[model samples]
Each structure stands twice: as C-alpha cells, then as structure tokens.
Target: MKQDEMIKLGISIGDLNGIGSEIVLKTFDDSRMLDFCTPIIFANTKILNFLKKQYKLSLHFQGIDHPSNAIDGKVNVVNVWKENVNINFGEEDTKIGEYAFRSLEAATAALKKDEIDVLVTAPINKATIQSDKFKFPGHTDYLARELGGESLMFMITDNLKVGLLTDHVALKDIASVITPDLIEKKIRTIQETLKKDFRIRKPKIAVLGINPHSGDNGLIGKEDEEVLKPTIKKLRDKGDLVFGPYAADSFFGTKNYKNFDAVIASYHDQGLVPFKTLSFGRGVNFTAGLSKVRTSPDHGTAFEIAGKNEANLNSFKEAVFKGIEIYKAREEYKELTENPLKKQGKKI
Candidate 1:
C-alpha cells in the first residue's frame, strides 16, 4: 500500500448506549478524513441516525450491506442489525452486550476476509461483552484466540510504546500468570512488532518490575530478583535489546521510559496508569503481535457522557490514523523482508 492509498478501516460500533457512535460520528464529521481512508462502521444505521439527530450533527454516512460496497470520499456504515434497538443512556444489560458483539463479529469477519485493511474498535463493556460466543478476558484475548496468535496490549504513541504480559488479570493473580516465559514471549512479540509494524530496525525495550524497587533487592519481594532479572539476562544473551526489571515507581517519574522504544508492564495498572496519564487524550491501544492491525481509543465506554455529545474524538481519531500507519508500515516491512538481499544489490 502506498502512503496516500485509501486503507479500509473496519470499526465495530461498541456499546451503542455509550460514546462509540458519538465519536465515530464526530470523527467522520469532517470529510477530509475520508481522503486518508474509507471507514466501514459495523453498526446499525438507525442507531447512528438517532445519535446524529440527537446532536443535530451533519455527519452523514452511507449505509451499505457489506464492506465490498464501501466508497471513498464517504462515510460508510454496514448494518449488523436492522431492528430499532432502544438506547437507554447510562445503562448496562445483556441485550446491549449482544448488540455490541454483533458488530464486533461482523467486523472481524470482514477483517478475516480481507474486506477491511485495518480495524479501529470502539469501547465495549468488558463485563457485558462476555457471552458464550465471545468468551475471553478482553479484545486482546479474544482476538488472540480468533487470530491464532499471542496478543499484547500495546499502548502506542510517538514517544513511548508499552506492552503488557498479563492483560485483564486481577492484581492478585498477576504475579502467578506473569512468569518469566510469559514475559519473554510477549517481549519477543513486541520486539518483532516494533521491527515489522513500526519499522524500528533495532528496538530497545524496558520491563517494569512487579515489586517495589524491583523487590528492593529481595527486601520487598523475590519475584523481581527470582523471575524478572534472570528473564532479562537470558533474553539479552539471546541478542534481544531488552533491559531491566526497573521499578514501576521511578520508571516514568525519572523519564527513564524515554530511553527505550517500548516498555512492558507486569500488570495492567502498572503500565496503564502512567500510559493513560501521558497519552490518554491522543494515545492508541494497539493490539500488537497480531496478523491484522487493530487499534482502539485509550479510554473505555464513557456511559456517563455518552449522549451529551461531549466525548473527545482525539483518541479515537488517533486510533484510526494509527491503524492506517501500522498497516502501511507492515506492508513496507514485508516488502523489505521478502527481498532482503536486494538491500545490498548482491554486493561482492
């Protein structure tokens, strides 16, 4: 794909009652965004119209039956459902969960069929989205299973990239699930993603410690000393530029994260707190290490502010751009790898 080529962006309309439709409507409000990529929103046309009318917005999009009919210079919506579903703002129910999953399933089907080039998922209720058909911790886990690869919850921006070994696990169980092997696997995925997806030839990664002060040299805990340090050493010995069981407290405070290309958090909060704090408004939650490109806004379904038309579209907009950027980068990366010896022109 060329730099200015139109990438098909598949968007699963998250919980309709939340800000998913709002942000989606707002993002495509400007037709200039259409120049960059054609957005195929997997959502109910009627639901989107309701939001548009409620806000008195002019974000008109064409409703189509399939992504095959997506048109450039227009916002396209593929209907996943037809019935007029009532939206009770600031509410959670099983019906809402089912509705959200319908969009996600349709979008992923398109992704698998290559109908869409990249995906920008809207926020869904984690608790609600857990049905028999969709049984996983979150998007990363669900996509990992569906796509047949390990997924890393990578927070990405121009300055910092953070990947999580243990995603959506309770804090208490994070230690049990995040072993050295798990760390190495996820880190390896991040390394490869940085190289291929982001075009970082040699990426430096930082691993934050689970314990305080990396277990204070085993004073506070031993997991850092016993598990994390040894893991870093073995990975480094294998020629990966990975560093540290750095203490979570000072890792971002001292601007240490600036020294690396990416950081791996032991658990969700240890990484997300600093990440959201720094990149919340414009950051992207990129599901790295997958065969496909998937990015979402850093925040969740803002039920409180859903219908108020007050949602910030920066993060969601960034998610859309990030998806396109990664797609282009991966394509270019594949070209380079496919013709590796071409770099030297068969030099003697």
Candidate 2:
C-alpha cells in the first residue's frame, strides 16, 4: 500500500442514542481527517441527518451504495438503514443496540474482505446489546470470535500503555483465570502486537501483580508469588524484556509505567481505573492480536449527555488518528522486516 493510495477506513457507528453518532459527525467535520485516509461510515443516513439537525454540526454526508463508489475528500457513508427510527438520546433501547451491532458486522465483513485498511468503532452499550439476536459481552469478545485471533485489550495514551489479562470479568473470577500460562500468553500477545502493529522494537513489558505488594512474601496472596512471578521469569528467559509482578498501587503514581513500552494488568479495574483517571477522554482503546486493526475511544456511551450536544468528540478523533498512526507504523515495520539490508543504509 503506497502513501498515495488512500487507506480506506471503516467507522462503525455505535449506539445511536449515545455519543457515537455525534462524535462521528464531529470528527468528519474536520477537513484534516481526509488528509490521512478516506472514511466510510457504516450507519443509517436518517440517524446522521437527525444528529445534524439536532446538533447543528457542519458536516456533509455523501451516501454511497457501494464501497467502490466512495469518493475521496468526502464523508462517504454506507446507509445500512433507510427508515428514521425514533431515537431517545440518553435512553437505553434495544433498537439502538441492534443498529450498533449491524454496523459492526458490516464493518467487520469489509475488513475481512480487504475493503478497508482499518476499523474505528464508536462506543456501544453492552447491556442493551445482549438480547436474543445479538449476544456478546462486548466488542473485544465479538471481534475475537469474528476475526479468529487471541484478542487482548490495551489502553494507549501519551504516558501509559496497559493491557488487560482478564477483561470484563468479575473480581472474584479473576484469580481463577490468573494462571502462569494465561499470564504468559497475554504478555506474548502484547509483545508481538507492539512489535508488529505499533512498530516498537524490543518492547519492554511490566506485568502487574494480582495482590498488593505482590503478595508480600505470600502473606497477602499466593497467586502473585506462585503464579505471576514464575510467569515473569519464564518470559524473561525466553529473551523477552518482561519484568514484574510489580505492586499495582505504587506503580502508577511513581511514573514507573513510562519506563516500559506496555504494562499487563491482572484484571479490568486494576489497570483501567488508573488509566482512565489519567487518560480518560484522550485515551485510545486498541484490540491487539486481531487480524485487522480495530481502535475505539476509551470512554463508553455517555447516555446522560447523549443528544444535548454536550458530548465531547476528542476521544473518537484520537481513536481515528491513532488507527491511522498504527496502520502506517505496521506498514513501515513490514517493509523493514522484509528487507533488513535496505534499512542498514537509511539514516538513524
């Protein structure tokens, strides 16, 4: 893929009632977005028109019947739904959930067919989307099943990059899944993803301990000492720059996360709480180990402030930009890997 051949990006419009539509509209309004890649929004034209009227945002939607008909330097939207369904901003509705899932399915199909270079998804309501027709925990699990890869969720920001070992699982169940093999698998996934996707050479990973002070010599918990420590040692021996079973509480505050390329969190909130607190609106959620590139905003569907025109579009914009960055980086890394001697003569 040459730089002149514009990368085709597919945007899955998440829950219509949520901030997904708003952010998508806002992101396209910026002309600079076209400079990097051509965007195709998989959404209903009626819903987008409604948002335009409600928010009074400056955006023009060019609906295309086919992907080949998509125009450059314009917001090309593939209208999935024709009817203008009732949308209650901030209210949870099964209809919106269905629409969101449909959009995702369409985007996923396009990615698999190589119609799109990258996929940027907006926020979706997990609870409402779990009905009879559409049943999945969230995008991570759904995407994993669709793409056929070991999926790992990683939060990326300017300061911290953290991956979850067990995501969207209960706190009690986390320990049961925290085995040496699972930990090692997640670490290796992160390592390979950083090198291949993000183009980080010799990535250093920090694994977080499940217990406080890493079990304090087994006084607090045995899993940290028994399971996590051994996993870290095994990875180190395998020539991976992996360290710790580190204390989760003190690690974030001491700026230790900056020292590593990525951190592996034991569970959800153990890493997300700190990550969101620090990089909430600016953070980008990237799904690693997938066959295709998928990135989304860190925040969820903010139902309370949905249609009030008060939702922030910064995170979605970052998600789109980060997707482009990673895609370009992956291409560059592939070039270097294919011809290492070519890189030898290049400037350092």
Candidate 3:
C-alpha cells in the first residue's frame, strides 16, 4: 500500500495447453498499465513466447532471474522451467499439469517471502493438476494449505459478490460438509472480507438456502428451515447484517440480491452458476480469509478456445485490478482498526 514502491504483481501461468498464456499476454499488452504496478510472471519464457507467436503479438517480455530484479515497465518473466515445452492446446496431459504446478509453487514461494504484493493466477486444469506433490482439488485447497488459513472461495464483480460454504467438492461430498459449523465459518469469513478487503463497514449479507424451495416448510429438506434460519439469527445477534435462507432459484431471478452487499451460497454451483451467468467474462475468484492476496479469473481453461485467439482478457485484467484494490483496501482497513474511536450509540 505504500505509494513509494510499485506493487509487484506475481502471476502463475496456468495449464500451458489452455488459454492461460493467451489471456495473460493480452492482459499485459497495454504498456501504459505499467505506470500502476509491475508484473512478475512465473513460467518459462519459451512457452509464453510460443503463445505470443501463435497470437501474433508484438509484446516483448523481459526475462529476469529474480522477482526483485524485475524491470518497472516491461512484462517480467521468471523462468520456472528451462526446457522448451511443446504447446499442445486443448489437451489435458501430464506435462502441462506438472508445468502448471511448478509455476504456481514458485509464485507462491515469492508471495510468502514478500517479494510480491498480490498474486493473480491464471486458470489451471484442476483434474490434470493432480500429482503426488500437489493433490488438492484446486487453487483454494492448495493455497489454504500453503498459506495456513481458512480459505473461502469468493466470486467478485462490480455488480455482485458471492462466497460459498463448500468449494471444489464433489456433489455427493457437499451434503456431508454442509454442517452448521461450516456455514457459520464461511459467512464469518465473507463478512470479514467485505469489511477488510472490500471496505464495507457494515456488510449486509444474504444467505441462500440449500434446497429448491427452502425445504418448502421442511417437506423437501430440513437443513434450510432448521439449520440456516437459526444460524442467521445467531450470526446477526453478533452484530452482522445477516439475512436470508431464501431459495436459490428465485433469489437472483427476482433481482433480490441487489439488496445485500454480499451473498453466501450453500455450495459452489449454487453461487457460481448465477455469478458466471451474469459476469462470466468479468468475474474474479478471490480467495478470502487468507493472509496474502490472491485472485484468478472466474472462467476456466476454455480448452476449446485455447490458441484460437478468441480468449477474453477482461476477466484476467479485472483480477489484477481487483488484487490491487483489495491490497489497498486491507491496508486502509488495518489503519482504521489500529486507531480506535470512542463508542457511540446508533440513532434510528
């Protein structure tokens, strides 16, 4: 947040066989953006250069040995691998998966060492990124273990912000994980993120029900009527503007989500299905409750569009800007929290 030093942005190139490199390159093509922050990409220069050629891009990247040695105005690349990896677009192979993990691992190290201010990751093939070393489902699980925080997946955009109770889990596994405790923890994390990261002083959060008709008065399911309603009551008593056990089907369709600052969905699909439907090309997945700042584009690898010069860079660009905004917001929030003010009563 110090204005003296440029915010060093660390990026992990996702599955090389996908549209990660294409979107990343397009996001940094505008040299004027360098005036704001510096980017340090963790990937092989050869791989990115291949993407560049395929896309017919004129942009040049500076190969740096270290993140700290990155130039101010140029797109900086720290080669994580030395080999010239082949570009096999639209394939979920072991080689690209290993490469993606290598880049993410190295970038995460730089983040922990305070070499970068924020991390904006490219999309990785979650199924393929599995290996002996990295066995997590996706970025949230891996980053949660690496950073040691109760990471919650939040989808952010200018229009709406939604966080999930269970992220990157199988549908069968979600039912077991949907305990009252998990719901409460995820909402708490979302509340804190809205306050600290997004700078919402009194965040009004809306929680969605797990069932289609919110259990239809317990005829379909009891979790919504029994678990969610009571949890909202408890969380609200603790001084949070929490509301809802509304059915997910009608919440967004009726334009009700606009009334709250943030929404907590019962699971990943319940939240993301609506979020991506509205803000598909512009949404950013923010990992809230982590000590370090991390975000990624809302969309996935888009294997069909890889190397076709059809990938949209809007989401990736917004991810970088969102990272910078959250970092600044956190700094300001810390300053405000440190200097306490005298208590005052509320006026109706």
Candidate 4:
C-alpha cells in the first residue's frame, strides 16, 4: 500500500432488520466519502433499495457483479445473495440474519484475498446470528476466528480510549479469567496496535485495577495488589510506559484518563460503563492485532427508532473515517519502517 494510492474498503452490511442499511445508505449520500477511499458494500440490493425508498434519500446505488465492476462517485453494492427478498425493518428474521452473515463472510473472504485494504462493518444482532451455521459471539469473535482468532477489542473516542481485558463474557466469570498472563497479553497487543495502526511512536497505556480503591492495598481484594501491581511493574521494567491498578471508578471521574494515550480495563463493564457514558453514539470499535484493518460504529441496532429514519449516522461516519485514518497511518508506518531516515528528526 502506497501513500499516494487509493485504498479500497470492503463494507459488510450488518443486520438488515436494524439500522445498518439506513446508516450505510445515509453515509454514502455524503459526497466527501468518495474522496477518502473506494467502498464496496457487501449486501442485498433489495434491502438497500428499501431503505433508500423508506428514507427518501436521493442517493443512487449501483449494483455490481464483482468488485472490479465498481465505479467512482457511485455507491458500489455487490449482491452477495442471488435472490432478492423483502426486508421488514424493526423485525428479526432468520433469513435476514443469514444474509447478513453471508455478506460479512463474503467481505472477509475478499479481505483475506487482499482484494480490499480494510473492512468497516455495520452492527449485527448477536442472538439472531448465533444459529446453527454461524455460531460466533459477534463480529469481533467471528472476525477473530476467521483471521486466526488473534485480536482484542479496542474501543475509541476522541477524549477517551479503553481496551478490555475480557469482553463478551459473563460478569461472574470475569474475575476468574483476569489472570496476570492474560492482562500482560492484552496490554502488549494494545501497545503494538497503538504503534502500528495508530502511528503512535511511543504509546503510554494506563491499566485499570480489578477491585475498588485498587483493592485498598489488599483491604477490598488482593487481585489489585497481587495480580495487577506485579503486571504493571513488569511492563514498566520492560521500558513500557504502563502504569496503574488505578481504581476504575475514580480514574474516569478525576479526568485521569486524559493523561494516557490508552486505558486497559480489567473487565467489560469496568471500562465500557464510563466509555459508553462519554461516547455512546460517537465512539468507534476497533479490533486490534488483526493482519488487516477492521472497525465498526460504537452504537448498536436502534430497534426503537428503526423505521422512523431518526437513526444517527455520526458514529458510522466516524467509523469509516477512522478506518481510513488507520489504513493510511498503517501505510505510513510501513513506509517509515522501510525507510527510517524519512522519519528521522521529523515531527510525528
């Protein structure tokens, strides 16, 4: 990938019954999208048409047989399904789920074959997609499995960025899985991604503790003192700017999150509660440590306002923009790595 070359993006249409089609249609309406990268959406044309008619959008979608038939200034949609089916918005159907899964699988296959530069997925319903054929947790797990299952969930906002040590797990089971090795692995993965994908030369990561008041020095729980502290010390001794065992509650309250480049939460809610509060409809979910770039909007399917056309495309728009940014950044990093003198004494 060259800096001057155009990046091609393979987009997977999320749940068709949800607001996925709406956001995809709305996002392509913006003319500025053409300036960033060439987008190829893997979805049913019938569903896209339904949303366009429902929303009364003026944008036109050009259905193509393959990625090579795509044209500029027009939304290129590849029909992954052979048959055109009726889509009922705000209602869940197994056929729609299967179609969504197929679209994602097609996009993933294209991505694996180097046909596209990055993948920007729309949201999908987890339960609906967990049938006999597609038995994965969500996009993160599904993509991880497809891409050799080596990845971590990295959620981002302009103000705060949090990476989970354990995601998509039950609350009670989280404590048992919060081992020192797992914490170290997640931290290292995030650190590497910050450098490679984000173009941060030296990323400073802040690790959140597992207990209240950071275990109050073993008063509340020993996990903080016994597990988290040693891991942070180890990472620091390795010349990594990793600190904490910081109490999760006060860490975000005192605006302490602003000090570091990224935050590592011990469990799911410990990080997402504050993260969602600050960036519910504005954040971008990035899967770090994949061979190829992958990103999605932070928000999920807004079933309540599904057909009302009140869904906000801001997060989806940001996800696309961030995907482009990461792809470009990764290209630059690769270039810099190839030619170290190009970045010498240059302000990063």
- Runs of candidate 4 with Cα error greater than 4 angstroms are 345-348
Q: What is the lDDT of residue 320 in candidate 2?
A: 90
Name the runs in model 1 displaced over 4 angstroms: 1-5, 341-348
C-alpha lDDT score of every prediction, in listed order: 0.89, 0.88, 0.89, 0.86
Per-residue C-alpha lDDT of model 4 across residues 157-260, encoded as one tens digit per residue: 76778999999898788778888899888988998888988777799999998888889999997888888899899889989999998988899989999999
- Residues 170-251, model 2: lDDT tens digits: 9989889888888877888898888987778899999888988989989998998889888788878989899998999999
Clashing pairs in 3: none
Better of 2 and 3 by lDDT: 3
All-Cα superposition RMSD per candidate: 1.8, 1.8, 3.3, 2.2
Cα lDDT for residue 196, candidate 4: 81
What is candidate 3's lDDT per residue for 127-178, written digit by digit as tens?
8899998998899989999897779999999779999988878877866778
- Give one clash count per candidate, in the order shown: 0, 0, 0, 1
Residue lDDT tens for model 1, 1-348? 666668999999998878888888899988899988999999877888888898788988799998999988888999898998988877886798898999999999899889999989999988888888988877888777777677889999999898998878888897788787898889989989999898888999999999888898999978988999999999999898999989899889999999999999999899999999988888999999888999999999999998887999999999999998899989987877888876567743
User: Candidates 2 and 3: which is better by TM-score?
Assistant: 2
Tell me each candidate's TM-score. 0.96, 0.96, 0.96, 0.95
Full candidate order by lDDT, most accurate first: 3, 1, 2, 4
> Over the full model, what C-alpha lDDT does candidate 4 score relative to the true structure?
0.86
